[model samples]
Target: MSKHLFSASLLLAISLVVGKSAWGDDNAQSPEPMPPQLEATIKAFEAIGGMHEYRECYGFPSLKFHFFGLKLDSTDADIKKMPVVPFPFAFTSISNSITDLGVAELAKQKNMRALNLVDAQISGQGLAELTHVKDLEVLNLSNSSIQDKGLEALSNFPQLRALRLGNTEVTDDCFVYVSRLKDLEALDLRFTQVQGKKLNELKPCEKLQQLLFSGCPVTDERLQELGKREALEGLDLDYTQVTDNGTKTLENFPNLRNLSLSATKIADQGLEDVGKQKRLQRLYLSGTRVTDEGMSHLGGLDQLEELALSETKVQDAGLAKLSDLKNLNNLKLIRTQVTGTGFDAFSDVPLQTLNLSHAPISDSGMKAIAQIKTLKELTLDHVPLSDEGAKQLASLDNLTLLSLGHSNIGEEGLKSVSQMSKLRVLDLSDTPVSDDSIKELAKLKELRLLYLSGSVITKDSIAQLKKALPNCDIQSDSK
Candidate 1:
């Protein structure tokens, strides 16, 4: 059987074992018997390669179940021989191949609290069948054929807490029904026709916290209506028309913690307003006009943890200003002008992960990075590091994952890399290292994964290295 089918069958067997034990105990209080409608629904779902899991609730025999409708090559006759499931599902996901008949069977699951129908063929009329699921709190119909009339079916789910309609045909007219969901907390309308003009319709949802409008035509004027939502915490405006003026309205959301302005017209002036968000934890400014000057504004965001500055003009001087962000741990400077001169500034920042792929890092920069003792993962793909520069990485005693692909590191560098006894994953693809360096790589007794694609190592050398490190998953061009 295929891997998907094998996994589903194993889970079903385990669930049956647990169910038999629970039901066979006369002294144990068993869950209420399954209704006939639910039994038929489970059988119908199983015919379409569906899998269900049951778990005991609060130390009691009463169990709650989750259903998954996976697309597999199993035939209806094969599924008919499987054992029956005797529990109600609280979560159901019917993606890619669900039909109207399948959805009609799903409506009988009154205990469903979350449903995902992404990329399904069901229409608005099919969605109306789910109105009986009063306890449904989360619904995802992204990449579906659901339109404005189909969204009207959501009026029956006033207690819904989250809804995602990305890449759908729904327009601004759908918000008329969406605005009535007063208990809604999160909404995703990415890549849809619903512009921000009608976003004010969501004012009744005072508990709204997260809103994603990425790949939409949201303008600065329409964005202002969201300024009054002080309860808002996360917002994504990637690929929108909003500029620096649009970001000025962000200060009204004092509780905002995560923000993404990638691929937008936001410039250095916008970072000035973004710096005002003292509680901001994650920020993405990739593909923007932010330069070295804008880095000064981010110094006050002491709570910042993750920041992405890829594909921008940020250089060494820009990184020096971020030295005071002690809480910052993850940073990406891919395709930037950084040469590693300011890496010493992060010595006291406790950074654990850093990516500098495609950057012009020099030998001195590699030497400076060696001082960061807390670094556990590092990437330097497409860098012009010399053999001596690659050797400097040996000082990172805690390094577990390292990538030096497409660099000039030779056999001498691989010798130093072998000294990292704690290294778990190593990538030397597209480098100048040859068969002579295979002995050095074999010394990594703890290495679990190794990649040497596009290297000059011969097939004989790879076979010998594989024999030496039998536990390692070595991937070389010769293989």
Candidate 2:
């Protein structure tokens, strides 16, 4: 689905660095010649209209694809008569192009494996055409109108491993078909008409490791069905009605590493079980009822790397229990009751990214975490800090991103933040900083994104800043 397969992307990024001059190594003796087969593929891609040239990285040969823009008479019938492109991947803005005849023609290319028709007008009849694609593995039909009967066509895809039907019109009746895909490993049913009890149909999907039901209308009883699954590794039940009892169902996942319970009704009763998941590496509990009592249960999660407890009832005492999690590198505590001594918890850890936005952190509270020399990104949005507290951030040499939005931090206080030469993204929106402080940010040559909304900067000032940092994306609330 990406430019290349997941393993291929990784290979290109880190592993494929020794062989070719494409790796861009300075001491290369000769330029590696492209293979004839690969050259033919490139020629085929160029033969198609609106194709972009490939760029190599990390010595990995770039994938070749074609793009055809606004074809004046593009239609489903028009696409049916069109010939298969020279390459396996392509992007075309053909209106109503997922019709049965068009799909039949596209399926003739046995080499094609990944296709994206997101937000297309494909209906039941049109979707049935996908049954012909035996080798297609990744299919994205998000935001389509494909319904129950149409879903039946996908049950037989031999190589279909990843399917996305999020925001579709199908309900439990459609899930009955989804259950038949035993080979399915990743499934996203978010924002759909799918509801309770019928979700138990997923238990039969033995190979399913990643399931996202965010924004689905599911109850505790229905979600508990997941307790029977042992292969699940990533589960997102965010914005569901699942309570502590439903959270217990996740205990069935022995290999569970990534779980999101954000905006649920889970509290201390469930955290005791969550704390026992020794293999957990990432957990999100934002917008839940977790309190200090629940925080005590999580002290044993030494393997945890990323944890989000934002918008909950966790205070200073609760946060103190998480200080020893040396593996924790990312923490989000937005709008929580954590403040004052709560800030003391993170000073001992090597935190690289922290979000304390919408909390009540004062100058002294801000100083507590300044000792966290490893902090690379920090968000103190709406946590009003005085000028002295703002200056404490200057000691953090690794700070690359800083957001002080609505902190009431004035231009004088911003003088200290302006000294963070390594900062690439800065959010000073909704603050009292004016032109004087705004101009100081221009000195940061590496700054790429600057948010100036709700500040006193004018359109002319933004224009000048844009000119100074021609490549930076500087946004202001001029409108």
Candidate 3:
């Protein structure tokens, strides 16, 4: 019987025993009677492990006990002889040096569910032992020194759903063996030598939803094949040779929503196909050759919500097209060229994040952004925004994170931003703010992280500021 029902039976037995008076007088009241079935159930529990820990609940239709991490090797043969918590599910760790092959063997024998041999130093030989467990669902072999040989052994597991092979020496050929497991859903091939020839064999599993090919040789062409998978929802192809042609192939994937094409040759023409995919919600084209021309195509995508163009050739003109995408919520133009005209494009859209670092924006650009009352996060690092721009930004009551690092803002400009009570993370680095304005910052009790690097403020000033705001994490490179 379940442990919970067994515990309830034991409690009923104790109440029955306490109610009966062994030597009661003839006139004395009879003790409360107990159920005989409950007493018998207690005897059954005592026959087993003698109840180390047990609980019963009628509110929810489930029973659980804490026999995990308990030593099954006891001196008493009565308890020592029983099966070691058959199908150990919540068991935490098993040392390899102990040679407890019975642990994995028992799981297979009893139809156990989850097995985590992560960082256990298991190799091909150890993995071979697990293939017999056909019911295995989730297996984590991360940092276990599993090579391609070990991965080859996993092909036998027919029910494997999630597998982690991070930080292992497995190569691209490993995907060939991994692909054989048709039931596989989630896989991690991060930081492997899988590229070119190795990547050609990596195809979509029937149920695979999330796949991480970070630091691998997966180009845009491979991602194009992946995009066609009806089940694929998330794909990461960061730092690959895939170009706009590869992305065009992805238009075949009607279900694709999130795609990362960072550090590639994706330009405006590449985005033309991407813009046509109405299902695309988020696209990352950072560190590429995408310019304002690419923005023209992106403007046509109705479902486009988030776009990241960091470290690209995207200027203000490209961003103007985004005004047509009513669902566009976040836009990152960091280290790009977004001027006043581009900032005005967001006036109609409700954006939450706007990163324009290393741009050449003036006060006019800030005024244009001020029209976006939905803006919560704004970055103007290394830009030419002056005190007037700062004043315009201070007017946005929804502003939470503001970075004015290396900008031409003075003490007066910094003071203008002090009224933003909702500000959480502020970077005033390389500005002309002095110790006199530190007191004003203390009023922003919601501030969590504050950066004052390369500013005119002194070390003593930071120390005094810390004293006023003891709980805030202040980072200053002034020394």
Candidate 4:
């Protein structure tokens, strides 16, 4: 049973035994029983591995249920029992099991604020059932069987703010219905057949701030049509046919804050145009041709907070250019050419999260990284960290999570790791650590989780270490 259900049952048991209400008022009368419809709805939802909990919705506490990737095998009798609830529910990836009948059951939720049917088996006709949900603000039908015919139901939702139709059968013909949603603020058409021309129909959506066409065949000609949307705050064109020429359209969106062009043909010249978006806070350039030259263009984005340059040609020299990004906190440089030589440039940047996995960072790089005292979580998986290099990490006193899996750290390094008294989670998996390191590992009394998997540590040593740190969840494999 779920924790919520168990607590409810326990509360009922206490109420009966003490002759008091569940709210702990002895003199107060018992609360009214749940209505039959509500009870049946709860049972129908729970039968499909759905879980509900009270969460703050708007200002007041409201019940919310979530069903993800679960096969909805509830019988027709159970479906009939699924009545309307004055709450929201998410049915994501409940593939092919939920048909028009299931959607009709969900349609009874007239007050639902958000509905997610991503990758569901519902058809366009099935979506018509949700037309009665007048207050619905968010609707996601991405990767479903929904087509243009089903989108006609969208016109009924005047309060709709965010709509995701990515990877669906909907073509440009669907935008005619989508354009009717004047309140729509976000629209996602990723991996869909809709080209850029039909997006012009969304001119009615003046509140539209976010538009995504990632993995679509959006070309420069079609993308240029969207240049008029100066109010756009976020736009994604990852894996599109857009090139450097298409990047020129970015200059039109002065308010763009979050932009992604990952896996596109955009290069340094395109980045030069991207650099002009001074207000950009989060930028993704992974799996592109971005090099050190392109990195120079991002130096002016002082408001940048998160940057993804993984699987790119970025090197240590490029790090110096990003030092000006004072707000940069989360940076992913996985599979990059960075050796950590220019890490000192961020020593004063207040960076808290850094991932350098699979990078050939040397001992000098580790020393440079140690200078950045603000890091709280660091990932160096599959990196070449020598004993001395690993010892340098002890300087990061604030580090709570550290992943050094598949690294070259040894017994000497394990001794230095024990010095991180504030570390709550540590990953030394697939390393050369052995039973001899148990003495040092036991010193981490504050550790909540420790991973020693794929190490040569014996089962007996792990037991001994566990005895010293009873609260720590130690995971290891016996030699």
Candidate 5:
């Protein structure tokens, strides 16, 4: 079974513990945190409402910051204390705090690869000092005060690869500076005024792999030109007016791997063009006009691994049409009409992860789910899973995670769950598991983390359970 099964589960980790998240990577090499200084610095920045993503870059984890979340009043003097995050603590960002003086200070750092100042009130002339960071490779000036002059000054960084100018004031008249870049791979210009002939001026950018334009005035003609590019791998056209004409153009993209068409005008027929792409792996069609008939076109997508049909028209009958998708390991059916009575739709299917939270699967309907034997994780939040239906899950011995919170599971259900003993994470929060079932939970000494919030557990019961399962990180802190 795939390790991402619990990724869509309603169970959230307590975050205080250093264990596997109930809904994230289970095969953790090591669920380790950064060093004390690095963690403190990140927490300090996060305290000011900065959102960031960290990834391994050249042997060190680098951060990508979004400065739009910061208040407009944030000053260069206050933001100038940019942490000295070197390779091991590499700090990359879609936004950063830098001035002419700040950029001069970065010249000493040799390994800095990416710099950003998004939505910040920095002056356009401040970019003149950016030429000092000679080793920089990625730059993001999205939603900043930078204009044609500041945007063109970026051509000085010959090694720059990924650039984002989304929501910027830079116009089509100044695209030559961007199109001339020799090694640019990923370019994001979403919400910019780049449309019509404005996009064509950058036809020289052939090495582009990912082109993200969500709110730009993109059309099928631009998409058709993109389809002809052999190196383009990812495209995000969410919230755009691109219809089936634009989707059909991508049917023959040789290397397209990830496609996001969320909130678009694509109906059933637009997906027909998507099914023809054999190399596609991840497809996001959330918040669209696609129905069950549209899913029929996806039956031939044998190579697809992840599919998101949330808030679509895919019901039991429509979902049944996807049984032939044997390679499908991840599926998101949130806010749909899947009643959970059609286990046959998943029969013999290698479904490692499945989300049916927003559906109307009753306790009796959950009986149909017993057919999935290879399931390693199961999420039944907001369902009608009572003691009877919860006990039926003991048959799935491979379950490392079982989330039944916000349901009707009581003492008997906990007893039934305790018998399995193989579960590493259990979420009985928001249920009626009372002190009477404390002993039943205590039986599982191997449990890593348990959520008993909103349950009728008492301090005495928590003490007893703590004594019974000394290793478990019990979250009986709530009612």
Candidate 6:
């Protein structure tokens, strides 16, 4: 009885397989084993294939990969047919692969340029396969099980320019392997085990341009070592363990243009050190120990274009230091205790953009800011500005953007700003401005964006405003 049952089960299985072959599934054969040609295409991506289908192959001068809605380990047959190409194409990207395609196998592809194997089950062996792609320029292996050994595979690529190893197991040992790429330009090591020791390993890439080591455990000394490279353009040291002592290292990199030290333990003294970098264009010091005293250091940076001091201890007293930045353009002071007195600091400066949203600046503060004849963009969200205060913004003859969202400005107050002929963007969302006040804005032919959502403006009033400014976008509550 047992033998008969076994035989019957075996026959049933054979019948199902034969039936599937004869009839086919959806008129197509199930994915079969990878063919030799397709296997070779995977090995030699550049010469045999193009970018992932979604990616524009040949769009850039470097590399390309066609990645379209593909998940890792979707099917082995799909992986074998992946495309590879150089830049100047369209729609190319990198995506996660579930299973590890051993590094040796990846390296076999002589032409593969763009590889997006992020969050794939890549191990040390899989990473090693990447060493063989001598022509690879862009490799994104983010969120993989990569360690120092995995990084070792990258040492073989002499032409690699952009590499993203964010959220990997890279350490000092990994940097040793990374330093070998003499032509490396951009390196993103965010959220990794690399510290100061890694800087020593990165010294080989003297031409390196951008370095993002955010959330690393490195000391200030390591940053100093990396700063020695004059070609370093942008550096993001956010959430690092570096302190004021570490900030001293940054003085070595005089060519840096963009710097982010947010959440670092650096105090006013460290900011003073950073202020000495005359080439600094964009600086971010949010959530740092910087105070009003540090504001003096930043005031002297003539090249500074944009600066952020949100949530810092700096008050109105410190704002006076910034009045000297003649080239200053953009400033953000969100969530700071800066009062109307801080507006005095911009009395002499020609600010183009200012974000004081959530600051306790009323009509009096707006009057002080209006003195900035060149002011183009201004935000007064949640301020105590009434009709009288809202009218004070009319002094800005060249003002193109005025955001009074959630303010006490009503329909009468908006009429005061109607005289701003150059005003292009007006955001009055959540204000008490009614339809009657909006009618006054229709005369401004230069208006581009008009937001009156949540206001008492009726549909007929919105239509009146839209009819007048046919080219403008009127976003009303009714919409």
RMSD after CA superposition, every candidate: 8.6, 7.8, 15.9, 9.1, 6.5, 15.5
Better of 1 and 2 by TM-score: 1
Report the lDDT tens digits of candidate 3 across residue range 346-419: 76787887878787887888899888899888877778877787788777878777887777887677777888
TM-score winner: 4
Model 2 clash pairs?
none
Tens digits of per-residue lDDT for model 1, 1-479: 11122232233232332212111121223345556666576666566666643332211012222232222232324333433333434443434666555565566666666666777676777778777888777677888778888777887777687788889988877888898899888788889987787877888888877788888899999898775888787788988998999999997789877788988999999999999999898888889999999999999999988899999999999999999999988888999999998997887888888999899999899998899888888888889988889889899989877888887888888878899999877878888888899889999998877888888899999999999999777877674
Tens-place lDDT digits, model 4, residues 1-479: 11112232232233332111111212222333434455556566676555443221110001111221112445434555544563444333334455677777766767666666666677767777777888777677877788888888787789887788888988888888998999877787889987777767877888787788888888988987764777688888889988888889888788988888999998888999999999997898888888998888999999988899999999988998889898998899999879998897886688888999899999999999999998988889999999889899889999887888888899999888889989877888888988889899888888877778888989999889999999877777775
lDDT of 5 at 244: 87
Between the candidate structures 4 and 6, which one is better when assessed by lDDT?
A: 4
The residue-level lDDT of candidate 3 at 234 comes to 54
Give one digit per residue, the lDDT tens place, for model 6 in 1-479: 11112232233232222111100111222223333454443344443334323221221111122222122343334445545422221112243544555334444456665566667667666656565576766666778777777666776677777777889887767777778889887777889987866476676788787788889987876776664778877787888988999878886687877788888898998987898888887888888989998888887789887788877888888988888888888887876777657767676676887877777776666677767888887777777776777777778889877787887887677677888999877777787777577567877888877777788878888888888999787777674
TM-score of each: 0.84, 0.81, 0.71, 0.85, 0.78, 0.74
Model 5 regions more than 4 Å off? 1-89, 93-101, 116-119, 141-149, 165-174, 190-197, 215-217, 225-227, 363-365, 420-422, 476-479
Off by over 4 Å in 6: 1-91, 94-133, 143-147, 221-227, 343-348, 458-464, 474-479
* Candidate 3 stretches greater than 4 Å from native: 1-122, 129-144, 155-159, 166-168, 196-204, 219-228, 453-460, 463-471, 476-479
Question: Could you give candidate 5's per-residue lDDT for residues 44-120 as a string of tens digits?
Answer: 66765554433332110111211111121234543454444444322333334545554444455455566655665
- Write down the lDDT that model 5 would get: 0.66
Candidate rank order under lDDT: 1, 4, 2, 6, 5, 3
Q: Supply the TM-score for candidate 3.
A: 0.71
lDDT of each: 0.76, 0.69, 0.63, 0.75, 0.66, 0.68
